[model samples]
Target: MVAEGAVFTTDRTVPIGAIDRWCSALLDELAGVERELWLVVAVTLVVDVWLTHVGLQHGLQEGNPVMRAAIETFGFAVLGLTKVAALGLAGVTRRLLSDRRGVVVPLGIALPWAGAVVVNATLLLRL
Candidate 1:
């Protein structure tokens, strides 16, 4: 008999039970992707910080006036603090948005950080 939550496919021979199991597994994996999106944001942020650190060590200046002052006043450790604050903001954004739609929070953060990483890496390479 056909089972609840079973996935439909063109193949007719597969049992409904197997289809349901596969669908459940696929749904679980999809859920994990949303979680991984946040991980991507965190990782990119770290890499961006690391690249910025290296660039600073080589005499490059921070372009952001606020961060430049923070680095000058409090030193590079402020970068870590900013990361925590950013993730907190992202968490709030995630909570405020619909469950599935919250992927935008990480994507938005990660993309800019990734672009920064690319820019920093390219500039560092020229040195």
Candidate 2:
């Protein structure tokens, strides 16, 4: 089973009208691509802050003594931020490609590298 939020690819069928409606809704939101980018950035920052504190607390409280030495409280926060940044970039790149619209084009270009770095840093380098 795919875990919640786990990234995967699959094919789906939907009516053209449905897709059009969805795109229209997205475009109508908050006026323009710039605002959308700002909103994404703000949300990413907020999530980074909250996830960092929570990950640190959880690691410190629940991990074994040996695990404690391997994990840095703040590092988790950084990792979270990195992931968010990657996703934000991807979103921007996708939007831009769709129509010089948002930041999705740049994001699409950067997200893969960002994700790889984050994964290696956290899982390979840190632990």
Candidate 3:
């Protein structure tokens, strides 16, 4: 029997196996997201390479000092290495995002790459 205005509550504990399954599902989802991110990184690298070629043709130089030095000293090999580094960083970003869910993480992952795309497009158009 319950009195008027009295509240009843029930507490349930999740089973360990259920919790493990849930965690595994979540990790699988994150892995899918990471794969998508890698795809984006790959596409971005292709576009970056094309942009670099266009920029070179137009006499535009690498803006980052370290990359500029690499380009000057080691040529296209360094450019390839830099693209590889960018892909690695994207992988790192995906891992970080998996660990920490936040709006800023995705934005931080995306904005700079998007900015580069825009800048490259603008330069290619202008040249």
Candidate topping TM-score: 1
Model 2 RMSD in angstroms:
12.6
Question: Per-residue lDDT tens digits of candidate 3, residues 4-96?
Answer: 998876877778799878867766665557546546656766777778868877898877788888788888668877777766775576567
Q: Number of clashes in model 1?
A: 0
Q: For each candidate in turn, give its C-alpha RMSD to the true structure in angstroms.
A: 10.7, 12.6, 10.2
Better of 1 and 2 by lDDT: 1
lDDT, residue 40, candidate 3:
64
**Per-residue lDDT of model 1, residues 41-125, tens digit only:** 8888888999999999999999899999999999999987998898899899889987655666777887888899899999999
- Estimate the TM-score for candidate 3: 0.58
- Could you estimate the TM-score for every candidate? 0.71, 0.34, 0.58
Ranking by lDDT: 1, 3, 2
Q: Deviation in angstroms for 53 in model 1?
A: 0.7
* Angstrom error at residue 25, model 3: 17
